[model samples]
Target: MTEHAPTTYLLAGGGTAGHVNPLLAVADALRAREPEASVLVLGTKEGLEARLVPERGYELLIVDKVPFPRRPNAAAARFPLVWRRAVAQVRRHIRDRDVDVVVGFGGYASAPAYVAARREGIPYVVHEANARPGLANVLGARRAARVGVTFAGTPLRGGEVVGMPLRREIVELDRAALRDEAATTFGLDASRPVLLVFGGSLGARRLNDTLAESWPAIVGAGWQILHAAGERNELVDSAHPDYRIVPYLDRMDLAFALADAVVARSGAATVSELTALGIPAVYVPYAVGNGEQALNAASAVAAGAARLIPDAEFTPDRVRGEVVPLLADPETLGALRAAAEASAPAARAGTAAVVAQIDEALGRSAR
Candidate 1:
């Protein structure tokens, strides 16, 4: 009997958690399914993947950080040489590792990986995590073997809604069963409804300021607060019995379990996780970006699974007027929860669907 060779995969992406997290999730799933297979990561030395991929027990291949120049500047003049070098670097890695397939999550490294894979006649897949596709993914999707997206209606060629590949802790979490433990972990009353608030790792100053002004009213309305005030944030924890503020939340699964409702940014991962877990939320789209955050939360708002509060409008008055009222109205909150639950089927199948896509691409390459 002949033994088949182990499949080798080159998973590429990384910069922010938005790109790195999904890439790691898919890598973990691939490794779990086929322990003998080689799962490698391609990233820049400066990216989050440099640290995270190694920590996750995957080999990290270095790539040049070649940013696509937007305007006609000095960098634009040098782009051709830099871009070619990046592509050649990826090609060398592909040749050395004998990579069977390249899966990209869209970052500095992925654009070159896509080019290298195409040049080497290897199949490659693209996963876009936002409703507004990134420039790299947009370019890759044109000739990719398969294109997957976290949200529906993303304007990428051949893109399919594959949801967001989430962390295992989130995917396996049993919120109801873990509520009491989560409440104790945060020193909160599990019997009372808790409003969980966060704004990524650096913390959103807008969210921190607004909450500081309105926590008194929120706690007074019979709801407790469990707020992750970002690592760099200066928001001090108040001595109020119902308010608990922490610098960061290492165990977001527990925080999710204790949360009756959430007030946070509408990042792609955040939106996907909330919808998948059937957690009703009021989203404040970070106003700094190209309006993608607002676009990320649109479908949920349209489905009555969540509410949107623009950054400029997410003031203390708005929280008191809308958020506090919603908390007091259990009927509306229940409806939002039910809507989120109803919308969860597609959101929860992301990891499996992405793996299926990779398998299909491999099969096609073999044929």
Candidate 2:
């Protein structure tokens, strides 16, 4: 009789689709390489990962971790308790389920699991999706066997830079079909160019505020708007019949297909997806975290796939300057679109490397 080795992966992180999606990408890669591999996701119950992860068919394990408390006031006193609870959850999962490599995507949500993996002498790796390491990734870095960085310029100084991990759905979208579907579904007239605006999940308040205020000016210019506003965004209404406001967009393939241009935050995954689809975008990287958002948008802008708008001037003048010109010309739009497409992932072959790493790590652990 032949004996086969067992494989188990514990993916940890949550708080946003951005964090969870990359882990999903890695998981997809892992599964493709080893069809028999068992994968489980560890995240907070209230986060999108708990629902999105399992809904996407991965085993979902809810942990006690919360998003890292950024502001000093309210969550400061409560963090230790959260961390302690999270540690307990990690210990319980690792012991009962027999985790192999506990891969962490960036977020405070992954900290306890990473720490637990370290104490248990289990193989662990950290995958950071941003140019600057987030608090969670940074904490896990010291103990991680080999950190994974998506952006080439990540400041970790130690981890291997493997580039961004993108979902298979996004990477393999049928753009033309999406465009036609989006046009018909959203009542967009294909004759006029579509301007896509969205804020992932929590929505962009400042962006929502400015767009709502500038609605007359935008619509007056004869361009169509397909806006995906966040659930909590209170800035605008569906007052104008031409305006479409949904908290979340179900068909981003359709949304991106409908877009002649995109106005969005330059998150690593967003840029990666945009590049993957070869979509031209006007990037407004949020002005926070030592300008990490600005950094995320930089390569795309340099590659001519996108245009960056400084956060301060992201208002009327700059938006008008950047948005109006592209609205009219097919030649410029075509060039940027081609450039974005050209800059997209070559084969999305990061999966094989990841699976090899996991296999090697587990192999050594068994010794």
Per candidate, the number of residue pairs that clash is 0, 2
Question: How do the residues 65-133 of candidate 2 rate in per-residue lDDT, one tens digit apiece?
Answer: 566777786687888887778888888899899887898887756888888898878988888888878
Model 1 accuracy (lDDT, Cα):
0.93
Off by over 4 Å in 2: 1-4, 66-85, 213-222, 234-243, 288-290, 347-353, 363-367
lDDT of 1 by residue, 1-367 (tens): 3345788999999998999999999999988977899999999999999898999999999999999999999999999999999999999999999999999999999999999999999999999999999999999999999999988899999999899998888888899999999999999999999999999998899999999999988998899999999999988888998999999999999999999999999999999999989999999999996999999999999999999999999999999999999998989999999999898877888988899899888873221
Judge candidate 2 at residue 241 and give its lDDT. 54
Which structure among the candidates has the greatest lDDT? 1
What C-alpha lDDT do the candidate models reach, one value each?
0.93, 0.77
Report the number of backbone clashes for model 1.
0
What is the RMSD, in Å, between candidate 2 and the native fold over all Cα? Answer: 3.9
> In model 2, how large is the Cα lDDT of residue 195?
80
